[model samples]
Target: MKGKLRPVGSPVPFPRISERQELPWAALYHTEFMGSGTEALSLAVAIAIRRHSQVSTPEVIIPAYGCPDLVSAIIAQGAKPVLVDLLPNGPHMNDVGVRGATTPSTVAVVGVGFLGIPERLEELSGICREHNLLLIEDSAQCFPPASASKPHADLVVLSFGRGKPINLMGGGALLVRTDLAGQAEEAVAQYPVSVLKVGMKWLIKRLLFNLLMRRLPYYVLERMPLLGIGETSFHRLDTISRLDLPESVLQAGLRDFQRRPLIHQRYDTELAGLEAWGWKCLASDRSEMSRNDPQQPVPLLRYPVLAPSKDMRDRALAVLNSEGIGASAFYGRTLPQIEGVEAAVGGRDYPVASDFASRLLTLPTHEGVTSADVTLIGRILFSVAES
Candidate 1:
């Protein structure tokens, strides 16, 4: 492989695109968010609480298996975080751990749906409502068709970002299903939207995608007299992808599965040799979004599952990255583990989420990591494991 210089902050496009794939539901709702998905979810969660609370602080329960954004959202809103670990890979919560830590101040339970795994939406929703607590579903993890149930959540936030179920350049959706929806909208709508930001995001997406697939002009590639700008040259809302999306644009163009690489079959071929890759498969081959299977489809962005151990996981990662296949030790540190959060949860444990964070690794399956690449990666991993 030839070395190309890309600035530290610049994004390169997917090396290839297959056109046959089923699009996930979250993509279509990206642009409608008032701010980042975290911001939107924060607004929704805050609105779910009542005006009068005697406690010095408000608090919400967050499972350990989550993006750091949840904690950031809590801090931004002046609320406290209650961290609870989740079950491995699946959306199951360690309710026992949660309740053990639950305090009288616990106002809400945040549930994030997971890919291929059934979300604990219904059960968690029931528990929250029964305990007179609010429930917020972070649909960023679980995309539509993957939603376990139309959860009876007080709030549900969706993400339409990179590799999300939906492939919008940038956006999140703030959904309020309970009595709080209208109130959340009022506050969210108060924030002014940015046109300049959205346009830039669109351009960066197009340019990045074009260049990676070798569709862009060679001048841009080499950054020569006509196009010598490096990836680090710009970071403005007008110059790069700031990830701002509007609702209308999303409804129309987000997550177009019809785009190429609908079936990243080449990826599967490369990685099929692992001793135990723990791929998350659909419960059924039926399409979750289309209501019926389409002729061509893009498989799920990630294949989430529990691996044997941390050492094996790291070893596998080393092998992949060594081969130029980007891999991830996903959500490595579960949010609920923070001291500020543990104090907030009243003392619940999040075994499941903890396990998930420690073990899950998202591989470079879709970004033109071909079947041959998979073979290369697998051979590396096999040698490492055998060693």
Candidate 2:
């Protein structure tokens, strides 16, 4: 692990030229690809706003702790983002908090699947039905995603960014249910299609990106402060365009979906004794929408764990990074603490989300992570806890 620097996640490798299969989800829902997950979310929120136009000032409920892009999506549609606390030490929203936050103006509830852990969409859907609110499943971090003969949520958002489950460099998808197909399709038709131009420039850029992903080059790049390797910042989403996907991108995503489960298994087995060290794995037996499906377990974008305390979490993070393992405290702060988002979410105290953020740390589980990396990560955690 001397000269190598593993990134927190790796992009899906470029696929070999081959016969392309039709994107699988297309058969399941009315799907539309877009420029980014943020754009896809913006469009979904827009549709919800229009459908609930009777509300004078529309509001959308979201978990207090998540990507600032959540706020960006809601605000882009001129809707207020009502932040709700998460279930204690959990990735999903607290049921009571979500219910308490709802009001006459609330138009939708965004359920985020954090680090590939699906939210309890079945229960949330029941809650939404009672209130006549739209339910949006943000599956940006999930793999082996939820789908059915019928749509699971009113809208489902998927991302194909650098660190996402299916990294296509940059793209996202919005799946609209049959009920909302008219509005969703109408909004989609307004944007010009973004056809990825695969040429010398694209080839060179792709090659360079793959090269930088290597340990030594990434180690050097990680030291460059201006690069801001792991910083989380918010950018206002202004445009939404449909993506014209190529067969290669689809093939690559398929390969990624098929390969990630083994990596997840390795991490789970290697990190088995975490509780003995006072650390806890977050991948517990939480119920989700896919509970009844034959495919019971799914791969997480990263394997997350909670340290006994924030001090121990910080120390273990340093040790993991020093050993060249890609470890991170994902979104180290709640949305309101992020610079550009405070005005939107205001200065509310989300005690649960704050505690969750402080103790959280995630390990790499992508295709690039080796067995030795998992072993080393476990050893380091044990060492830190024992200290």
Candidate 3:
């Protein structure tokens, strides 16, 4: 097991994106590029805070089962994060839970499309309007990415980091609706420009990264604890820096974004019958009103599914991971369970969120996932369930 070939859990694959991808967004919103997705979100949080200046100790509503980055972004703006439990056995927050969490200090609701499945942004938009709160679409994990053409939220955040739909090594963007353009622009104006360059050195690192992502090297790399191969931790967004887009990387990212659907489809088609064995494919449950159009299958950072029970999920994860399938129990805990999050967001019992976290499993959907890989993953996952 130790020496078997295994794909890297997350890989930075080279791809291309065309300028045409930005055309619809440019016409509908004010776009700004930043150093990372977390920075982009921090800035958006700042704008939301500014919009509610009259409220002291502003608060933002976020789902309980999500990246610690959400908490970090909210805290960076000197605001409080009000954790809302996710929908029973689903990725997004329960609409009722969000409504209950809102109070006078609540400034915004961050709707996350977890693992490439779009959140019910339209529903959240209506809720925001009713509550006079802003809606921020965190599109860090989904693709075709979020666009302004059918604007459902007041602002959008995108990440081009490792494992993201469009991995540009490091970069992120914020798309502000027309109404909030002034506030977003004002915030960007004060930020210092990033001096990062994507020259030969950066290219070499990317090349090396892709090389190491291959199964043979990744198998060795994953065992080296010092490398933190797939660790997720909270990093404070100290400052938002403006970055100049590298055309080559941006184009490549766009192209990679385009190629994702095929990989996603492979997973869907291969795992189609697993539901009979107690596996729940999240893609099948997407809301028709979600950002992802029914006609277009967007690439999710990973294909998320819910195992029948906590015991089964753990067993499946152990088996899949041991086989070097890159299957993971993402986050593996709700926000309150994370190291420092309970202190920031306060300790509260989120039963649904806890249950969702325990049962959730995510499989690699990157360009590196081959059809044979998909078949092997399905076989192993099914075997785990049967056993």
Candidate 4:
């Protein structure tokens, strides 16, 4: 019998983005966000502080269990990241976010769309003005026109990375306000282009996963565990590894978007059953409800649940991945624990941050996870709960 084939994953090209095409803004600011959107957004934060006349280091708020790269980005720019807890039930910046944003040192706020769960963007806009800080919305994981959530911050960054609702394996766009446009373009011009590998990896994924992944073996290929190649997919802006991208990548994205375009809707109809599946969603906190009366339905990211024990998350993620569906402790644990973040907060874990981190487990959803897959995962989680 022939030995099993190694699970050859998607290749490198600039990945598809929120739209099938490149962002119109990318033509304006052509830097590829190395590795993660956090890097790019943080860079925007650094740029925002440079405009301030005061020499005081800026303060920024990052959701407690989010991208550690984000915290590092803040520090690199001579700023402090004030950690905020997630909204109790989901990956959202909530009242805790508001509280964290209140500090006088806050020069900006970073918005993360956790697991594709879109945060309230408009609220961040208000937070920015009240504190006179720049609002740098990180739509890294979520696709957006930033419609309902509108914070006319000084700047914003969106990614075209894999697993992001729009699958652009390698690039992102930086959006600065009209006044700062010229300044941004000049500064970005100083930044280097994307690496060939980065572009190649993304292009491969788009062709492989988006275009042809469905045609391959549904089980044998997708479920091949341990055919694993150790690789760092996300490029940290902290290093000098920033790659100069070919203009063609940007042009491809812009053109594709105009052709197919990404549109955001509430959770998929098939996944609607999930809302009642004991997945306690983090709706807006009471304070948010009272203020602005944000009337729009919040975007649900992963169906996160409190694990029965410290080990449940790992066990669950392993099971889901083995079954060939994406699963993550996603945030892993509280930011205070990460080597990078520990340095930032001086190593103290707040109750909300610690508990939320420990208890949370996220499961992937989409029209992607089949009925059988959902049933399988639901059963496993339910079994874990019962056990």
Candidate number achieving the greatest lDDT relative to the actual structure? 2
Higher-scoring candidate on TM-score, 1 or 3: 3
State the lDDT of candidate 3 residue by residue for 1-387, as single tens digits: 334334222556554444545434666777788899988888888888888889999999999889999999889889999999887778878999898989999999999978777888888998999999989999888654454547888889989887676777788988888777876677678787786577678879989977777777787888899988777676776777878886666766665555544566787788888999988998777642222345655656677889999999999888887777888888989888888888898788899999988998888876667777788889988888888
Off by over 4 Å in 3: 1-24, 287-294
Residue 217 deviation, candidate 3, in Å?
1.7
**Residue-level lDDT tens digits of model 2 in 1-387:** 655546455655676687665554565668788899899998888888888889889999999999999999999889999999998878889988889999999999999988878888887888899999999999888754564423568999999888887877888988888667886766677778889876677767778887888788888888899999889998888877889877776687777665554466786687787788778888755433332355555567788898989999999999899888878999998999999999998999899999999999988876678778878887898889889
TM for every model, in the order presented, reads: 0.69, 0.94, 0.92, 0.69
Q: In model 1, how large is the Cα lDDT of residue 120? A: 61
Q: Which residue segments of model 4 deviate by more than 4 Å?
A: 1-36, 94-97, 145-151, 183-186, 193-236, 239-278, 281-324, 366-368
Roughly what TM-score does model 2 have, to 2 decimal places? 0.94
Worst 10 residues of 1 by lDDT: 232-241
List model 1 lDDT by residue over 81-170, tens digit each: 766665545546676766775677777778766552345666776777667777777777444433323436666777655556555545
Better of 2 and 3 by TM-score: 2
Q: Report lDDT (CA) for all predictions.
A: 0.53, 0.81, 0.79, 0.54
Best by TM-score: 2
Q: What is the lDDT for 219 in model 4? A: 45
Residue 110 lDDT in candidate 3: 97
TM-score of 1: 0.69
Error of 4 at 340 (Å): 3.5
Model 4 quality (TM-score): 0.69
